[model samples]
Target: MDGFYAAYLTGRAGSGLLLFAIRGPTFIGVDGGGVKYDGQIEVVDVGLKCTIVYMIPAGTPNLITGASPPATDQRIPLEFILPKDFWNGQVVGITTPLGPVNARFQKLRDW
Candidate 1:
């Protein structure tokens, strides 16, 4: 499973939250469910108002060629999982560096 990430800053820049559009495997539990991705995280765009200079778990590189700073196809190794329990208001999904703590909602994909 794989997806692209976009870093979103609230009012300013530098640091903020991450918006991910992932198409991967889903995890279902008695408590709730989520989407689990394996291997690595790919960077598509930093966002319209932001820019991701670099990421983690190098060696591989970004598939997008001819980037301005030359984006790598590398993958950032982390415990990334998007929980399906948004109403509960629990700190779930995308834990590593930091979870999407400010995620207002999650839109599931057909994957």
Candidate 2:
């Protein structure tokens, strides 16, 4: 199986919405593997409360489920601060080699 996973943090800082996300490729290795190059946030639409990320290929064409080799040792990190009013229900969409995966923001607590 080939996919991706993400870890994110979201919060309200005054009138702004703070967001930080880290994403990477995932796979179940057997006799083959996958490679992920570098990834970047392609778009952030506050109006739609959605973000899109794209992961570039490292030319390896194989999936890596364990220790990443030097060529595929890359991860995607995104940070943003937007209007709080537009981020009530934000979703992050990531495009990987296999396909697309989504992560939703949930309020953890209030400060």
Candidate 3:
């Protein structure tokens, strides 16, 4: 699935809690999920907030897009993205995949 797609937190039954593909040397991972500030909900927190940003290449339709509320057992928030601003780094989605683990990223076009 390319262009505008959605990723749900299927489960925490493995190595890392969040799973995704990104366009960087990083773990294709976002920041906040690994640690928790005092008031900030840690990725392990029950109602954490996660955000994902993707860098889209040119020529993609509906550069900005959103997804339906995940139909899974998790309570992910409604996501928003602006493909134009995302030319260098597009904003993907945001949600608490698990406890305090809020995940977010920018999907870089693979082409």
Candidate 4:
């Protein structure tokens, strides 16, 4: 799926933009405008799956399960890709610059 992320720089902080194209293995996430486009990200376990809520610079994260998909490959219809394997009855936490977010398990008919 296509998602949009925007960051603004204030008096002290610099402006930044993150564009993520998550289709296959090679998850393309880029951040620029302030710091050099050379940085890293760390993923932590959140009961259900580990996720890198904070990614610095050109820090890139790959899809946990699938092989790196082609840059131009199309996403599977109605597929919801999660950071980690989640049990049907389990709850998971998602962390970001904003804060921790919670998610509940739900079954989908397809994908």
What would the TM-scores of all predictions be? 0.26, 0.25, 0.22, 0.26
Candidate 1 lDDT by residue in tens digits, 1-111 = 333344322221123334454444322211011122233233334311112222423232221221222234433344433333332334433323322333333333333
Can you list the residue pairs that collide in candidate 1?
A: 60-74, 61-72, 61-73, 61-74, 62-72, 62-73
Model 4 has how many clashing residue pairs? Answer: 2
The lDDT for every candidate, in the order shown, is 0.31, 0.32, 0.28, 0.31
Candidate 3 lDDT by residue in tens digits, 1-111: 123212322223322223343222222332113311111111323332324333322332221122222333222333222233332333333333232222233344452
Q: Evaluate residue 23 in candidate 3 and report its C-alpha lDDT on the 0 to 100 scale.
A: 25
Please write out the lDDT profile of model 2 over residues 41-67, one tens digit for every residue. 323455222233324245533232222
Best by lDDT: 2
Weakest 10 consecutive residues of candidate 3 by summed lDDT:
35-44
Alpha-carbon deviation at 75 in model 1, angstroms: 4.7
User: lDDT tens string, model 4, 9-93?
Assistant: 1211222344443332323444443222222222336322222232222322232222242344222211123444342545444
* Order of models, best lDDT first: 2, 4, 1, 3
Question: Residue pairs in steric clash, candidate 2?
Answer: 33-62, 33-63, 34-62, 34-63, 34-64, 35-62
Q: Give residue 96's lDDT in candidate 3 (0 to 100).
A: 36
| Number of backbone collisions per candidate | 6, 6, 17, 2
**Superposed model 1: Cα runs more than 4 Å off:** 1-15, 24-75, 80-82, 86-89, 93-105, 108-111
